[model samples]
Target: MSIVAIIEFDEAGVATGSRLGDAATPVLRVDDLGPTRGDGVFETASLVHGNVQALEAHLARFVQSAAMLELPRPDVEIWRDAVRAVAASLTSQGVTSGSIKFVLTRGVEGSGVPTGWVLGTASPDFTRERTDGIRVVLLDRGYRHDVPQTAPWLLAGAKTLSYAVNRAAQREAARRGADDVLFVSSDGYLLEGPTSSLLLRLGSRLVTPRVDLGILAGTTQADLFTWAESAGYATGYELLTPDDLESADAAWLVSSVRHVAPVRSVDGRHRAVDGELTGRLNAALDARTS
Candidate 1:
């Protein structure tokens, strides 16, 4: 089952209130720019038990995305309330694991009002991917590593509603007999996964690609880094390449809902999987309360 909360915004685009409604009900106008031109931003947060993990991080990124699209700033307090309310409702229905996605759109064309809503749904079991691991292919993202700086107009790092390319990349991965994709810059620098962040274990150090490479700073990766640091693992961000990935002791694609999915192979080339460390990582992720 799914739940929805339609956020009511004032003329200034400040969230004034929200109403719980059936997820299947039609709420958006036919002319909404979100569906039409994909002119909007969104954030999906993991819901574990009754807690919304990395909520503040998600909200911060949400506002950042909206600013990138020049949409009105989201009122954090109201949006937080709506998200928690929906999360609580889903938990009440006995959902222990799920996801909550909140979105803000540039409303119907020329309406001068933005449409917003929060949708929550139970999560699918990903035990196999988290344990058995997945295969991935490195696909060129058609942008240079410095795209975020050179072409900010492309909204490289922002998590916007425009994701046709991302979906297409996943489909292309399937056609290639891979489970997922790791996008490389046209210039041959390691970037990130379509919907996830790249993490590599280089000896005792845990590293990820630099955020400057037009990748969404991973909320899940941030949380895991914190725990990893506490657990005596060193962490850092760097400009990486396929050679770096090839040399890593182990690697994963981390995200909000899926947590950590170990990459078992790259382009059908078998890679080592650190089962012990992967278990520890997922355990730490599942234990997050804030």
Candidate 2:
């Protein structure tokens, strides 16, 4: 089952209200720019045991993406209400683990008003990937690590609706017989996965790639860093390389809905899985209240 909420925006493009609707029904027009030109921004947050995890961070990123696309600034309060309502509806139906994705789009062609909606649905089981782990391959992202600085027009850090390239990368990974991909900058610096962030455990320290490397800031990674600090692990952000990943005590592809999935292999070379620590990390993530 799924839930959808159509957000109503004012003349100034501020979200004023929302109404529950059928997910199977059409709410967008044929000429909406989001579908026509991929002119939009979106954020997906995980719902665990009825709790929406890292909502504020997701909302902040949503606004940043909108700004990057020059779209109307999203009204956080209204979007929050729609997200919560949809989440609550899913939880009421006994869906414990799910995802809520809210999107803002440049409205129909010639119409200045924006289109927005929030949708919620139960997530697929990720137990196997979270436990046994996945194999990944390194692929060139065709951009330098400094692309965000040199070319702001690329929208490299923004979570836009244009994901054909990312999907194509995943398909290539499949062709290579790998479960996923770890995108490396053309200059050979580690960036991030198509749908997740890379977290590496180096001894007692937890490190992720710097956010300025034209990658989305990982909300899940930030939360894990906070929890790791309390759990006696030092954390830092660095410009990492494939050597760093290969030398790490353990590595994971962390995301909103998937939580933490340890990387068990790279290019078919087996690596160690930190089952105990991975379990603890997922437990901490699943226990988040806000």
Candidate 3:
């Protein structure tokens, strides 16, 4: 039984229609650019214990993504209300923890406006995966690290809804019996995971790929870096390679929802899982979210 609700918004960002239950579905025009041409942007957040984690950050990114796609900037206040409305409805239905997604599409072709919505549903259980860790395989993203800077039309840094390639990479990883995919640039720099940001521990230093290299900036990674730095851990961003992952004391796929998930293996090579460090990082993450 899934507890899911899709809340629709008008052109003005006002919540118009809300539906619950398995049979309820969203009605979209066949020509909607979000579906037809994948012209849209979205942000997903973890709603834990009735609070949406990093909501302001998510909203800021949401607006930035819309701007990157040349879509109209949505009203921030209205989006907040929409999120609250969805959270309230789900809470009334006994949902304490879940995922919340905010999406905005370019609307029907030539309409010149956008269609937005908020979806809240029960969060999937990843406790086992988080505890035991996950296996990942490196996949080439087919673009050089500097492509985003030189080719703006590719929408490289923006978290747009055009995720066909990302989804396909994950499917291929699954085909190879891996849990996820770590995307590498054509230039051989370790970029990010299909759904999460890649992080590694080099002694007391925390390292992640440079965001300027076309990977989506990870909210969870940013928060963790702040907290870790305050706790006396050094953090740096540079072009990393798979060899760095192999040499790290520990590596993790970090995200707002999954928190800090240890890497059990990458391309069949076992990476050390420092349980103590993972626990500390998880604590820091939980403290920030809480």
Candidate 4:
């Protein structure tokens, strides 16, 4: 059974209706650019204990993405109402822990308005990966790290819904018997996972790829860094390479719902698991979100 709720929205971002646990329900028009041309922006937020986590941050990013794509600015209040309505509806349907996805797309072919909605779905079980860690492989993203600065038209950092390439990379990783992929730039700078941000520990300081490297600024990474810093750990946003990851005491792929999953190996180069650090990081993340 599909444990997902699809909520449709009107121009004012009000919920028109909802279909629960039905994946075959037609939610978007065939002419919608989101499906036809992949012209849209989205955010997946963890909904814990009936509260949407980091909603404001996600909204801000969604608005920024809309502006970057030349789409109309989303009315936050309308979106707020729609999201709360959907969340409340899902809660009534017995969803205690799940994810809320916000989507805004260029509307039906020539409609001149954007299509928007919020979807609530049960979170995937990542217990084994989180507990045992994951094996990852590095793949070239086929672009330089500075491409975002050099060409704004590429829509870098926009969180657009054009994810075919990212999905394909993950599929290739699975084919190679790896759990996930870490995208590296043509110049060999480590970037990020398909749906996550990369972070590695260097002695007492934690380092992640620079935002200028054309990667999405991870909200989970930001939260972890803030908590970790106050708890007496230094952090850095610097260019990192595969060699740096191999040398780190530990590394993780951080995302909103998945929390933190340790990287057990990279390109089959095994590293010792720092279970203590992973536990502490997860503890900090839980404390903040809980």
Per-candidate Cα RMSD to the true structure, in Å, reads: 0.8, 0.8, 2.6, 2.8
lDDT of 3 by residue, 1-290 (tens): 23434445666545555544342555467889999999999998877777787888889989889998998887787777777777777777888778788888988887665677777888888777677899999999999999877998888889899989889999999999999989988888999987899989999999999999988889889888898899899999988998898899999999877888999998887777878888888777666553
Give the poorly placed runs of model 1, Cα more than 4 Å off.
none
- Candidate 4 lDDT, tens digit per residue, 1-290? 22344545566544465444444666688899999999999988877667777778888888888899988787777676666666776777777667888888988867776776777777888778777899999999999999998988999888999999999999999998899999999999999998999989899998899998889888889888887798789998999998898889999998888878999988888877778888888777656543
CA-lDDT, candidates in order: 0.95, 0.96, 0.82, 0.82
The residue ranges of model 4 lying beyond 4 angstroms of the native Cα positions read 1-25
Q: What's each prediction's TM-score? A: 0.99, 0.99, 0.91, 0.91
Stretches of candidate 2 exceeding 4 Å from the true structure: none
**Model 3 residue 70 lDDT?**
90
| Clash totals for all candidate models | 0, 0, 0, 0
lDDT of 1 at 287: 94
Instruction: List residue ranges in candidate 3 displaced over 4 A.
Output: 1-23
Model 3 clash count equals: 0
Q: Candidate 2: give the clashing pairs.
A: none
Residue 99, model 4: lDDT of 81
**Of the candidates shown, which would achieve the greatest lDDT relative to the real structure?**
2
